[model samples]
Target chain A: MNNSSSVIEPKTRPIRKSKIDYSQGPAPVSVNPAWCKACNICVALCPQGVLEPDAEGKPVVAHADNCIQCGACWAHCPDFAITSNYK
Target chain B: MSIAAKEAGARQDSDVVLRYLRPHVKFPNMWCPGCGNGVVATSLIRAIDKLGIPRDNVVLVSGIGCSSRMPVYLDFQALHTTHGRALAFATGVKFSRPDLKVIVITGDGDCLSIGGNHLIHACRRNIDITTILINNYIYGMTGGQTSPTTPAGAHATTTPFGNTEKQFEACDLARGAGASFIARTTVYHTTQMDRLIMEAIQHRGFSLVEVISNCHTYYGRLNRVGQATQLLRMFQEKASTQPKDPNMVDEDSKDMIQTGIIHRDTEKTELCDEYQKLTDSLAKGKSS
Candidate 1:
């Protein structure tokens, strides 16, 4: 069939689905307050409810032990304020 | 140590993501609260950071739009050029200094209407530049003018009567124009967006990622989408992964904006790469 080329394109990637490990603990979260703009995106998007915002709207490690290290905050912080240590 | 002291110590530690950003970046950022541009910016930073591309090797170029303000916040060699001309400027940068990784941040109107020529030509040439077109359906910074991607019957400030023009599917346009890598994802789908952008950055030929973001300030208020968060929820409901079957593409995702990589042609040689090979062969021929 003329469409044989397009049909076979998806097969190129193979089925090696590599899942990222978000559960490598004791993963401590590091935050630089100076870089923090008190954006609540980190607190809102946290999958484990690991972060809680203080009165100033800056995220605090309310439950550091519960962090699964998914890196949602580490990658999504507008100010680039947070980091997740997989160690 | 006490709880307060320990928390303070943890706060002092630096983040790897922060290294990509400049500490002296201006704030409060130009994008409004819940405006998806911030998320797009952060996702872009993560993609570049994940690629481990050196700061000196990366150049972020942008046109005049709310989304284009992304360059000001990053530490990359950024150029906030004229409206709808980011791609044109980026092409020049890519041609002159082919060694650098060039990225173009543009908006719906900025790219499609004004910079439309640049977009299509860039794809046709298959230049080694990664372009992220932030589509919000309206010209948010220009106070909600109807852009080329504004859906049929959608309301904007400039269009009190619902827009009758058909929306341009950006991914389809890029694909038709011969871009090597083309992906579509929304701002709310940060994880998928992150991965797609990372893949786009690493792709050899011309690449594009159209991030369907929300303009809560102007487009949201005028169109009654409520706020940024509500628009994000709507995106979640309306977005879906594209089907592998090329024929099922239109039929399967008629009601939704299809996400994920829609098209990729890995065999196509990049503009700079081809140029280098041509020059190398020419030099050899002359010597012979």
Candidate 2:
């Protein structure tokens, strides 16, 4: 029991999660072409196949309905090109 | 609400990370398309934003390497110093101005090899500086040379047959050197990376967060790993959340690296604070 006092505890955070209200339907996913280098990472990582690569390997929002707005693509985009509308 | 108000609301949702970047730092950055450095930089910006630290009060110092190029893209008081001396320069900055938060961004070769002495002494001094050592295992900038942290069986340009030396566990090295706080997380663990960086910054003494990033352009191609996505998936599969003894030679978790805080000691004295006390006592004795 002496070790109990020394054990580190994970900090508690506010329970609120996700800025997008899912009840309002799926949010829009936009890709900024200027910043995008056509890495195909967002297309490969989209869990629902919401994004598809066009002729030049650039990611295009092909199936917006499939987007759960889980932010996997948003968080993994190496170029910071993808953004899920939080408003 | 009118369509105009809705459009305004949507525009604001573009990207919260852009507010932290300099307006003129070019698009797409200098790293390879799927390099993990970009992802690490994004997490860092988000962490800084969450802390609400004023941009002017933060200083970013770096030494020459792919990871050291971070200061060029990030909008902060930046200094791109010589190779392997980022921590030395950062220590000077902390001593002169104790009010600012100094962060050092370095790579595997820069921190563990040439800068090895500085790393140990900085940890020993326990100064209030946060170091983010991005360990991608190989020297990506110099064409995939095997670094000190590269695994024994891993292949690099310098060691095509296979690296024969045992890897340096960076977190254990920091702990042994007397760092007050130490944490490790991969680029695959974005949320954990953000939380650990925030915690490391808030810690009162010397804090080290070794970020295991992907150098897909060099490390991945040399090792026959598919791409950045595949490398990230490998990290997700290989890393364990539980803490393990670095010294132990466990067979079950031999391939796994621990994520989360590895060690912490808050009672250790910070160098600058102790120096201030010494100066105060000296002045009082002179007056008496």
Top-scoring candidate (TM-score) = 2
Worst 10-residue stretch by lDDT in candidate 2 chain B? B5-14
TM-score of the first chain of model 1: 0.65
* Best-fitting candidate, scored by DockQ: 2
For candidate 1, the clash count comes to 0
lDDT of each: 0.78, 0.83
Please report how far candidate 2 places residue A77 from its true position, in Å.
1.8
Looking at model 1, residue B94 earns an lDDT score of 95
lDDT of 1 by residue, B25-142 (tens): 6665766655678778878876777778988899999999888888888889998999898999999999999989999999999999999999999999999999999999998887
lDDT score at residue B136, model 1, on the 0-100 scale: 94
Q: Candidate 2 on B1-288: residue-level lDDT in tens?
A: 654476475453337667777789888788887788888888888788889899999999999999999989889999899999999999999999999999999998999999999999999999999999999999999889999988888889998988999999888899999999999999888889999999999999999999999987777877887577778877887798787656868765777878999898989999998999999999999999
True A-B contacts kept by model 2: 0.51
Model 2, span A1-87: residue lDDT tens: 011111212224332333334456544688888888776667666666667777766778786656656667777777878877643
